[model samples]
Target: MTSAPAARASMDAGRALPPPVLVVSIVSSYLLALHPGTLPRDATTTAVVTSGFAAVGAVVGMLLSRWASRRRPHPDTQTRRVVFGAGVLIAAGGAGLSVWWQSLIRAAVGAPPVGPDWWVAATVAPAAAVAAIVLIPRVTAVIAASAVALAAGLLAPADAGADRGQPSPRTIVVSEFGTLLRGELAAPEFDHPAERLVRSWMHSGGLAARAVIVAVPTGSGWVDQAAVAGFVDRFDGDVRILTLPYADVPSWKAFISDDATATESSITLVRELAKVLANRPAGDRPRLVLYGQSLGAVGADAARVWLEDHHPSLLAETVLTAPPAGTVAQASRTPRIVVANRSDPVVRWSLGSLWRPPAYPDDTVLGGRRVPEVPWLPVVGFLQSSVDLLAALDGPTGVGHRYGTEQARPVSGLPR
Candidate 1:
């Protein structure tokens, strides 16, 4: 049993990562991947998250390994066997816990239970763990993995069907800011989108509609089509919903980097619309209503505040669904209906949530449906809510970020 090659291999093994370290890295990461979030995620999302977490867990495990190595220096063969065996047992328990979590996630989100996708995730778990463990020990590998994760996150298709609803088919005048995604294709882009949109609307007889609903789009130029359809119903099919695409980037990216695009676009469109309305006879002018959701809400509120300052009587009403935490205060004029789901992370999450509890409207103010209470736990709540934001669009209609015709309800008789 003590051949030269076997003895040499045993000596070299001390330089390699400990077996228990690998087990800790993998099991801990996999468990967190299966943890419950506010909304359901697809198999791909789960796999990517697992891979990313595996990388983080491997780093954490290495730190623990370094600390233990200093205390023990070298472990006897029997001790190594005992530690590895115990780690395997713990890993087994973690696997069981992951299965239990899968069941809960499925039941909570009405997703299919333990099918082919589950098996795929199970297979990916070990591979991702091995890859992460192998790559994390080197500095270049660490940087490469981080870059890949960031790219994957940015390129990932927007939270599955984040803009699922389509615009109404009922002769609803659809005027777009010409060439919104122009720069995306390396095409020569032009300016004066507001003037272009106004010209198009005037030519399309939008001015003749009974109501003009200016729909400010989210950062990615998405307006909830269902909400637009609701606007048509509220106006008795006599409304023209206007949308101007601002940027082709995701809402989060636009929210942080170029929120000004939304503000500037909204102001331009609303200002142009106001001038057009002023030229018309008072009796012929259509009622102007402002609508936006999420980042679109931020932009619409900017324009709403501007309208209040410059032309207080121009805007009849404003409807904002799931507006961001601080945007409502900026657009604080009356006749504004803000529909925010109690479960929506977008409405509650902010940097300040780490230390301070988020401010929420009273139960009576929320009205109708509401999600179960989540006890705020300072930093923990902030972290959980941030994770929930990724799945914000995954819940049932009327819950989380998704809204329905209920968003069209009038603001009358509600507390300011």
Candidate 2:
């Protein structure tokens, strides 16, 4: 029979092997799932691929566990060390292969590559290292080193298809503000005042002849900067763009409290915008066009409501991209467009309910119990890509819920 120390050593060697195998299996499973070719072309295909990955992971994990338990004891420490070192190498190789494969897959799919998140790798590495130490006999040092190397590689920042080239025109001016002002002015495109006035008043009220674009900065404010530049480049008009800072809700709470003032700053900015437009000459009769994303979307919606209630004749169009929860319905009636992405994890959370129940009239809600189909997916994708390009220019985390290189398309006829 094998002695206690011999058996213990054997068990450790076996343990080391299983961890590498587990890492390989996990990385393989994720890559398989992410392969563009396997992505569900239809609802049925998606369900199949998702289920397949889950099942494979479960089966592989079980098998690895059983295999690791069956190894026999060996008295040679060098042999055990060799086996442990091999396992570490295998695990690191598997991780490296996974990353390389994913990059290739992304390129093949014509989609942007998945950039590395150091934070995620940092959290994953230590667990992997511990597993290596416990499983491999006499090879704990090698396993730890391999784990660190793998983690470092995985966590290293990568190019996310962001360097397509510099923007042709680097700045934009968003001019329409309040309810009656209508028009957009960009670096490359200039809006005709008469045409803008007609378009601004075409919908709800005939009183306002022009609209102003209000830029409300949220979070880091990079989005506001990029959006203004993009608008100026693409839009052909003389619309005015006003830059406004995010408002603090606590300060505004003393004035208005019945409603949750989560986006009080945005509301305050819109209210101030109306006052500014009112002071303009008669020809500049103010109409409003609001553009907001993520948290700013929520603020823009509140501002839209405030505009409609106070200056009914001045309301125009509202475009919200990837807005947070509780902001969709605010743009329901007016010429409103919402852009959302299916792959975006954050947007996925809010996809369940675009509008809250009770207040959502039966006619306005689409698809009944299931979430309504977002009519602006294409636009969202374009805007997302544009934001990505902008991020590359600015050298920051532009992929996360911000304005990027994605172009915003017109969604005029789609059902909300």
Candidate 3:
């Protein structure tokens, strides 16, 4: 009895998205944004992240709807009643989550709640959900492929013979030191750098120097110039600082995948230097210090452990700045000083931190100086800490993961 146009209309109506899908998407978006991060996000970032969450939520909602539909083919009235019930529950739950987020944010920052940001998320979530449900795998595929292509081009390792075009940030920093010292500091550019650097140091009469500091570089091969400057200041320009290039990737990537590169490279350099150091008398030998920050600290600590086992007397001191949780070795005889900030996510973030509170180094004199304590709340703490890791470096000199020349200060009463 129905006309063709009416039948087409009925089909279109049937294809319309279920009410619970939109509710789930919006709820999911808000839930993710509820977690407090190290840095409070701006409206733009909040919207973008919420939208991403909404898109994922939309897919999940669609699947959930399919399952529910198969389980119970409800009539129109029953569906409306179910939708109303979900909406009411969502409203009440959202209010509770909002209050919790407000309290955490308030505690982190003195005043001015992140209430407005929630609106940004709320406004963006439903629209993002609708778009995701409509433009799904096609749009996702294109974006993913493009992102992969871009990352591949940027991250691909260059051949040694290939012209890298411009020098990297690490090279610039190292080269700048050479220019500043007027060629007194030799940053080796050629192959067999460990042997070449030691040879250069020896040629420059570094063997006769009062002290030598082996500066373990960050994952990206960046040796902190401040730390080097601090060492120079401490030794009164009689210290020969040495470092070698390792991986050229970001610290996190190197931390996860190529951390062994740092440890092994450090060991190789120290071993070569140790062989040369052995030629001199024990009391006349240069005071050897191992210095590392962040990922560098992880490597340097591991090397320190190795040195303790093999060449114990060669290393005078080990300085580990902001080393990550669970990475420090327990069995080292060398005088080790760990400089960690109270609020440093790097020092606190581990698998165990998900449940148990992080334990600070009892031996560290410089640990936990500033910042109010961030209360730990089971799963919430883990989520916040995970987010905090991204912005750990954004804080001031003494806060979070940012350490200063103070990190290079010699431990009190330690023989330098």
Candidate 4:
């Protein structure tokens, strides 16, 4: 079913890349793209500037393709060369259309204009074009597939609207793993999963822990067991965790417009916990802690008002990780800890929340990693944030948008 030339070309293109080359290029490309600040206020003007950058990239890609073909005279190389040229052509057209498209959205919807700094994205146009010409042809397929997926995600119908949302639930989903962590003094005294909770007793032979935690699942509807392993093992005494089940989907897309789903589930969890907290005597009452990660973090944070209004109780603390944009109005008043990696893009897209410099509050903690320092370009940085987001999801924590570093370790508020 394959042609000789096509088969040969596939083999040449699919050769395994060295880890170092792969790591360096990805980091370089992402950092070069992320110089966000002070974008042009006019969306049209920003697009025009971005278009200018694409023109520059076309010329650069052509030159690189010609140079690479001469140095490596092979049919496969020639094919890549052609593909790179085509990519440039497509990119130029797309840039022009993207500007026009944004304009239409503004004209029709009365939405805010795209930021002026977004135009700076054009600066990386040339570099990205050249990389395609000289480096990985494999990435081409990924980009193409992503284009299709984006369309599908955007086209999906909207969920529960602002005025009314889905009804509340009577039962919640609870999961149990024998130990969230292994090693060093984690003994279960009153181990129970049937009540939809997990309780771990201290290794020092304590009867029970004096505190409890109720954590919501991530946007994807499951907990990152490893990330929470430390929380389970850190307590000096018994710690109880109650988790809700909204396992219908594994992505934030599942909850985008569905505020009610998050509100209802979180409300149910809090209400049920309040009943247990109400019954206990003061000395025996476990200190309540609220926790959420990623999408779960946003939902848990936002639902604070409703929880307080209806189930009002003093929570000892709320801990969140990789929380997406918490609008200025959604900012929390309670003492809570937010952990975010400087490289994560989900936080960046929120405009002012996690990673970008001008947006964080004085109390926020940022973990630094090396990023190629390029000139600060707002528009370009905005454009680059999308790429960095992908890389962060697939690449490194502190370096790309991913999280999982020692710096992010659970500290004193949790058990030792």
Using TM-score, give the best candidate's number: 3
lDDT of 4 at 149: 97
What TM-score would candidate 1 get against the native? 0.68
Candidate 4 global lDDT: 0.47
User: What lDDT tens digits, residue by residue, belong to model 2 across residues 86-156?
Assistant: 65565456446545544553443343554554223422443443444334624865654686699788853
When 1 and 4 are scored with lDDT, the better candidate is 1
TM-score for model 2?
Answer: 0.43
lDDT of each residue in 1-416, candidate 1, tens digit only: 59999877876764443646555666566556545445555666666666666667776777777787788765655565667667667656765665566666556556667666855665566555556566555764777669889998886646322543432122223435211111111101213666666777676677787777778877666777677667767767766777776776667777778778888778878988888887777777877888888888877878888889887777787888787775556336547877877667778888888898777532213532443444676665676677777777766775567778777666676321
Model 4 Cα lDDT, one tens digit per residue, 183-261: 1111121112212332122232222455556666653345555445546555542565555544344344655545355
Clash total of candidate 1: 0
Structure candidate 1, residue pairs in collision? none
Sorting all predicted structures by lDDT, with the top scorer first, yields: 1, 3, 4, 2
Q: Which of the numbered candidates is closest to the native, going by highest lDDT?
A: 1
Model 3 TM: 0.70
Report the C-alpha displacement of residue 379, candidate 4, in angstroms: 3.3
Between candidates 1 and 2, the lDDT winner: 1
lDDT of each: 0.66, 0.42, 0.65, 0.47
User: 61-86, model 3: which lDDT tens digit per residue?
Assistant: 66676677788763354455566468
Per-residue error at 137 for model 3, in Å?
Answer: 9.6
**TM-scores of the candidates in the order shown:** 0.68, 0.43, 0.70, 0.51
- TM-score-better candidate, 1 vs 2: 1
